[model samples]
Target chain A: MVEVKLFASLRTVAGEKGFLTDAASVGELLREAAERYGEDFAKRLQIATVLVNGKNIAHLRWKRTRLKDGDVVSLFPPLAGG
Target chain B: MIGGYMGKVLQVDLSTGAIESYSLPERMLELYVGNKGLGARLLYDLLPPMTDPLSEKNVFIVTTAPLTGAGAPSSNRFNITTKSPLTGAIVNSNCGGNFGVFLKRAGYDSLIITGKASKPVYLKINEEGVSIEDASELWGLDTEKIQEKLTAGTGKLVIGPAGENLVKYAAVFSQERAAGRGGVGAVMGSKNLKAVIAGGKKRVPVAHKDKFKDACRKWRQLSREHPATGEELPRFGTSIFVNKCNATHTLPTRNFLHGSYDEADAVSGETLAEKHLIKNIGCYGCPIACGRQVQLHGKNIKGPEYETVGLFGPNLMNADLKAIIELNYQADLLGMDTISLGNTLGFVMEAREKGLIKTDLAFGKIDRLSRTLDDIAYRRGLGDDMAEGVRFLSQKYGGEEFALHVKGMELASYEPRGAVGQGLGYAIGSRGGCHIAAGYPIYLEANGPITVDPLATTGKPGLVVLNQTTMEAVSTIGCCIFSVYMFLPKALLELNARSPLISKIVRSTFLYGGNIIGKALSWPAWTLPVPAPFFMLPQVQTHAHCTGERYTLGKMMELGKRVVSMDRIFNLREGLTGADDTLPKRLTDELQRAEEPRSKVTLSKMLPKYYNFRGWTPAGVPREKTLRTLQIEEEPMLPQTAMGAASTV
Candidate 1:
């Protein structure tokens, strides 16, 4: 199980700040979120920033980055300001 | 002479009641350009070393750039440059108020004000000319009240009670917008001036009118299409960074004791947009309209930026967005800077908890906050001391270890430990702890679409140099810094999204190319000709069109470098050494999290490299060769009035 958190436009689109899901990897977690939310969320998720436990997965394992039960996965879609 | 210039500068001396119109040199304009750069050069020429910021000898300059009123999007801005009472360093406070447009329209390129007024007075400038008017009644009024008392149909710059009372962190107000840092407002008050108003019917001429128009049109379109500038910013405003910063562990919480805040989302841009926003607003001629207008007690007012929210909210352990909004408005009305104000409060709250001072102020306590704001404005009780800013408070209260300042100015809202590069930036920043002046490297390290390893020292110094040069260059011509967001167009971000391999390549390129970019930046401007391939930076292009100059990438980078070098010399003359560029021990010695031993700002590791990239000695003085290359003469320049005629610039 992975804890997925959302912010900004993603939170608005999903209508929830975060939730728990049984996903073994970063790719599986995104698939679950995209499927649950719809095409709009999926399109955004493709380009959104993914951080596993405060570390960016882009420099990590990308979609293949494994997630443990306590792992916190945060998703942000092209955020601005500051 | 280039177009987009009024070509005359208004010089006023309140002591003798003398007003003169003069012109700046063409060489100076070409070298420094305008706004922050122009103002920095002007201050260096006009002021003596070690002059007291609040004394009659301290000079105040108001400068506008070519794009100021040339109908360029996000290009309407002005600068107020002076010595800072808070840090005793050079301060150039840029603002996006209507005053720049009005000042330019009134037929002047800049205003140089010196000496103290004989009495409480205000300045009025129009096509008729400039005059100092009696403002005995207007004195001591809040910012909103003073503006209302002034004549209508004019752009106004006024100070409130905090400024009048000589609070060190006082700010100048131009309508809802503020030149809100480094005690510029306090300097205005010291001169016994209350307000400066301008109105007229002059249009900024364009050298290449059609080309300039087309460039601006395309620039506007590109900005509109950028995800950060067009969508996220419009929807959430600057406070939108709350969540991102929090997630990245960059949010300043509990007096810089922690990096992340548990309740950051509650006071976030999203929350403000969802709960309190009345409408979206923007600065003059700005297309993004990133300013937030929210309802506070049934009256629509300006919203807080990320700085105000982070410092007032998470920094002080307060989570009430309504209270933060109220405090923000209150601070503005009082003519005080919310950044310094918030930091001072955080320090006091933490000091009280540590038994360093006896006060009712405590973290997460909101009841006394509003009254304390009033007290600070009026110089009453504990607020009086707090008004002096964090540096003074720490000195008196015996908490210098956790003072949370760089060279006496409080740090910005970003907790640099989360991004060591930002820490390096803050330490070496010319103005001391200002986020923008630090080149905002946090964007590349933590927030932007393509981020480097936040904790890695691998390529940070060269990267900081590249970023700082570009930022200072863009600022010189008067474009809003937000416009730089389009540097990463949506197309590239989309590519990064669809393809992981491309993302890796993009990240690596930015991370590794920094050193090469830094070296390339120092090349001669003539070497890099026009038509910089497919992606010409929108700013350099629009500037080239606005003024009939060959604004090449190298020339623009050189201008930015010269601006920084000019500041370096000024700071050196004013008694600040390279050693002065530093952060507090807490940020350097202690990690934000015990688990992350690498999370502290390793300034020593990057400072020498930064100096090397800057073409400065290890001690941080620009070499004679570097100065000559940049055309920065250490000797005080003869007045611009002596250099040329009204048609000069």
Candidate 2:
């Protein structure tokens, strides 16, 4: 099972904070998270930056980047001010 | 002897078309100091208790300090101070260019404008004299076109339709740079004024010229040596902070609902320099050429700053750098503040999300974004509502909870979710939600000697006050805040290298010289500490000591507090109560910590402590004793309170 944590405005759609999901690809994990939540979950998901464990997905293949069972994915939206 | 200042003030009344000149008062210069402080004092004195912002009675002032035009390093900035149509408080916005220098050379330290012009006109000041010229032909001309049409390469401060229409957040533009924020241009437009074109060949006289030269050398050297100032800012421009800020989760995106971005790399300064920048531009005598003349397609234009990049780019969910450049250009031409425009647009997008204003205004609709900008500036249909800015929009619609503004002014690029104290600063900031007005907790959150995790709430309120007060002084001096990154300590050092005359003055007056002279003069307790002449240092030797006055961290922090409290008092007199000073509900509640473990803003945990540190009442009104301590006159209109009553008074 993969653990994905949602933060900022994205958490509003994710319904809960972190959830355990059995998924193979990063795309699949997000899709499942959306299915379990609502359609707004997918639409609201664009704002967040995804991190596998502690490493950013930007270092890899972006959203298409694969995920593994027991892997941790953290999602955070952009913050503002000075 | 800071080099940038013209050491003069120009007062003009449009009602009779009369002009008056005055040498900046020595006491005022010593007490209130540069642009921001001088502005605070001038406006506070010149304006009455309940003056309407748009009335002929209001004064529109543009002020620069002694360090402004002086070949002083980074003294190439000036501020516009006026009553804001948006918030009806004191609003001062700074712009960097040759304008301040030109105005200074024209024999003015500041320009105080009152009354309304009978017709649309632009004020032209040359070596010959000042005249109010008909701007009927120049009206509606874009900033670049106006500059091109001017006879000489004079400094021109001009407004556009938005300002003319009194859009409230309209800005004044010159050479693509803007006196951004606080609707100064709107105030100017309300006065029926169009532009001010000024230039002069006269050299500004320096006090202790020899020591001034030495300070100039040192300041230049120090600026060149500093990593961010010398390298990053010069090479990549202010947009360089984009990637770094994103990495740290401080970048504002998606109407500040999110704190991270996907295509952050596309908008990074490094990317812009590599892809678009054609040449570097510098303001007056500044060594750091952070301004980039970017070439896109066949047109060359000033590139967007970090705030612009974040606002029009990722905040709208469009990461196209070229589009942002064009958007910035469009906004500039329209005389709209890019920050407020972007913020208002973001609010609209969020409204769309909440099923409020449905017109294809979604996250990544670039075409809609462009149309929306035009619509807002022109105040057409839904655009009219957006032009009122987010606060007005939220009120008109039904999402005050998600409205991303503090005091009507839209928040700047940096969002508060990642930096909690910044949120508090924005909430309590006197001039609505301004970052520079008091960028407190921000320094602590990002790059202070004492670092706090962005998510942390402790130590922020004190830090916020500290930032506000110090920034108040710096802006008052009319110097760029970037100097803080380079010469916070070295600016205070007093080793005389060259320029003997200036050296004596620096040693005798600036470098704790007041104490030495005061002791010698038998006035032990009355020695005044002069701000270090950071801008006046010789370019080559400035690295040995950064220019501008530098003080111990404690002293600097105290200055920040002083400015913050003074501004608070001004707001209190203006009828701002604690109820009006607060953060949006989402930031205080819905926005969660991403970096810090289980941390939220926890504003309730910080406000009381901040109030105590400020010596204000629990309700956040500045106490009469605090006002007395600051030497502020008691406001007669303050409601009388019954002893031990509910304290509603």
Highest lDDT scorer: 1
Off by over 4 Å in 2: A1-82, B1-7, B447-450, B487-562, B593-599, B628-649
Report the C-alpha displacement of residue B190, candidate 2, in angstroms.
Answer: 0.9
Candidate 2 lDDT, tens digit per residue, A1-82?
A: 8888664345545656568878887778777877887877665554334556644443245557777878878664332212
| Chain A TM-score (model 2) | 0.79
Tens digits of per-residue lDDT, candidate 2, B411-481, equal: 88876777777887888887888778645556446422112445655556655654565566566556677
Candidate 2 shows a clash count of 46
Across B14-43, the per-residue lDDT of candidate 1 in tens digits comes to 887878887777887888888999899888
Query: How close is candidate 1 at the interface, in terms of C-alpha RMSD after superposing the true interface residues?
Result: 1.3
**Candidate 1 vs. true structure, TM-score:** 0.97
lDDT of 1 at B64: 91
iRMSD of all candidate structures: 1.3, 18.6
